[model samples]
Target chain A: MSTFIQTLHLAWQNTNSLLCVGLDPEPTKFPGALANRSDAIFDFCRKIVDATAPFACAFKPQIAYFAAHRAEDQLEQLIAHIHLKHPALPVILDAKRGDIGSTAEQYAREAFERYRADAVTVNPYMGFDSLEPYLEHKDKGVIVLCRTSNPGGSDLQFLDVGGRPLYQTVAQRAAEKWNTNGQLGLVVGATFPKEIELVRSLVGDMPLLIPGIGAQGGDVEATVRAGRTAAGTGMLINSSRAIIYAGNGDDYADAAALAAQKTRDGINAYR
Target chain B: MSTFIQTLHLAWQNTNSLLCVGLDPEPTKFPGALANRSDAIFDFCRKIVDATAPFACAFKPQIAYFAAHRAEDQLEQLIAHIHLKHPALPVILDAKRGDIGSTAEQYAREAFERYRADAVTVNPYMGFDSLEPYLEHKDKGVIVLCRTSNPGGSDLQFLDVGGRPLYQTVAQRAAEKWNTNGQLGLVVGATFPKEIELVRSLVGDMPLLIPGIGAQGGDVEATVRAGRTAAGTGMLINSSRAIIYAGNGDDYADAAALAAQKTRDGINAYR
Candidate 1:
């Protein structure tokens, strides 16, 4: 019932972890009995959640992965399963949606009311009003995309807006103006440790959902060194394929649990 | 089965109209017997499509509206209905999705394969690779956001990236580099007639999906003048709330048809 930040802080303290296990269920890569069945999307993710919850501070399910397979029912089931089984950990639906004010309200409803996620990732390309509807949900977390993990993210994100880069401007605006309800966070890719440092300095201990570790080849030590707050706890470092698709056999769940634990400990070492 | 451009040209010639009827179904705005049924999303959209098909070159269903009401099933049915009834008119899924390459593939599958849309809108903020998956669908259309109509869109869109603005950079790249398969277009809001003119000059006859008409109060005369190609058929001028919600009684469908015909003829006059 607490706000997303409070829930995240509690999860971090209780689990002693900062790792956010990402559920990007691609059926082509799914193993064993779970390969092509639409129902297995939920079955596979539920097992991973059961296995990895001990080591994660949060769970982020990328909406595109489920919607691609026409398994939105399964996505709903998975989020409900997480809330029921793992009550402490917040679920951040990685949708990255943006639109004008009227349509953005619908997207906000889909994420918070339908899918029941504690937080949702959104794109900032449409600017202030596009994000206002999500921010109106005072208790839910609204994380804005700053610097992305992919190489092409530099296309517009790194453009010089005024003096600093566009992503820096995004971080500054998100922290100063958009955080009216204290529910805003920034998605800073771990690959760009320097940008992470810059965003961290600009936001001042606000939550940063750092992707691009593990499978994306980001240096974790450098990421933690740059992104961590003075108190050493202001990020949800996400690992998707590197953890969930870590193995291809029946033992995939165990492999995922092991991967999650190692990554959690790896993040903890610097913190 | 012709390419998207060929199909669009055919539709433009056959319909003799530039209006694109936008389906943004808000249940709260529904009338009479279909006020709150989840099935009404499809029913209302189907009725609107039937009434407006004679006056439209295309139909655009904004995905957020359906997802907000847990009506993705209805969205699928509505598209199928459009194809069955009005085969000449292309359906553009206005999703505005952007992500990394691998994830973008999932989103591309969702829009093109699952939804069976002739085209889909995308955000260009992530640059080349994020859009590559969608562009890879050689036969389908890929429309990228350039200068949006919303005032908040100016926040990052108008920032000077190089010599001009970020949107111009987007238009140039979309035309020169990303139009490899001849499946590229840009979204320039109808509200900004000058920017539409600028984008039209930059992209040189590539299709422009112009929204922000009708309820958004965009000047149709200026929009058509600024966006029309030398051939006088290169734009899909979209009108959402103003046409669909023209009446709230059981006569809503008749009112919508009247509005669609008026708008279509008005646009024709300018073209």
Candidate 2:
């Protein structure tokens, strides 16, 4: 099995895109036409995938979106569909799961074996042992949440430990110790440019799953400047609501494709 | 719509037990009789629930266990069964979920609406906003992860922020600012008695879901002594593998009951 990072790089090269389409299908936000379907979420997501596939380096389905609606079957089907139709695109299951050893193993199984996610985002609050379970799956990727793209992200992440911010320590730790299988990645929100630069320098060329690009108001230019490695690779700039919900009418799929293409071009121009 | 704490207190008073039996069914560990059965995980959990219901103040089914086996339907059945048979006991879904606002809302829905869990564990790494979505569910409990029970827990948790450890900061923040709905709780491991004492004092009478008792080798006396409030009524000692996997025979459920009873009595003696 190819490493998750290698698979992601292949997808990036094939699509010429850094844009990762976040497949978070909130039922209330769906296009009006799909309101009455038995499997509306899955049907809606299939259209989004069909429209946006060519422009995405990766597809991220925030598990909460599926789990919330008790629509995990849809999520499973979406992942399988993405794999079958767009094999080059890596899927990141954005479920920030963190726990002790035994339980962590189960979560690892959920992401890798059950959903077949190429990568899964995890919280590092429980320390290395919690992360070890995820890391044990050598071929799959473990994207550790560093500095998230949210207002409250700073509450705990920006704490000064020793002389550096906690997120910096997290970045340094992930690169040095936790990358044993060469399957580790960092999640730094595009909203914080300086932190992105700080983290980019720490992890070298390891992939950065950079959210906050679209819906969360992260600047594409600054994100491209700060997050990319010297080799001009290593970022998955994700856009969820902005691209997927661009049109709330029956032409939503076409709108999603156009939005994805625009975002992909925006990142490319900056690069 | 009684607050989760009040509901927990009522159950604690009625059951006269502080023991929370963790219903994490690993398929590989199942006894011979149920090994080949299609619905083995659910069947195994049902018997365990029947045997141990009398000794528990709460039942915590770790979501990873069910997700790993793709036996979520069983998990759903188990939770529904627990609610139907033991209506007074709150089911705490041990899914250490952490995400940003909109996504957090979906996770909140998953835990409360879908699973109908009374309480759920959440990681505090992403800060207050990540937690707010869970808190919005007024009557449900928000148990934040603090001073976890793993060897690597101290790696990030003990990092000093200004004058206090990060976990202490987390505890202080959760108690003072985040507990607005009066539905907040803390998870301090039984393995860390001093940390338990530290957290218990900080949170006052807020309940503590203390794991690490049985398979993790936490001391019952130390846990009860350090974790109890002045009223001696603020701790739920959890034991998963040690109790559930006690005897690998036809009497596995009986063994689980015996282990749970012993753990309960041990906690009682300390109280």
**What are the DockQ scores of the candidates, in order?**
0.82, 0.89
TM-score of 1: 0.98
In model 2, state the lDDT of residue B31: 87
Give residue B180's lDDT in candidate 1 (0 to 100). 88
Off by over 4 Å in 1: A36-38, B36-38
Q: Give the alpha carbon lDDT tens digit for every residue of A1-271 in model 1.
A: 2299999989988999999999999887878687656599999999999999999999999999999988999999999999999999999999999899999999999999999999999998889999999988889999999999899998888888777789998999998888888898999999999999999989997999999999999999999999999878999999999999988898999999999999999999998
Which pairs of residues have clashing backbones in candidate 2?
Answer: none
Error of 2 at A139 (Å): 1.1
Clash list (residue pairs), candidate 1: none
Q: What TM-score does prediction 2 earn?
A: 0.98
Worst 10 residues of 1 chain A by lDDT: A29-38
Q: How far out, in Å, is residue A41 in model 1?
A: 0.6
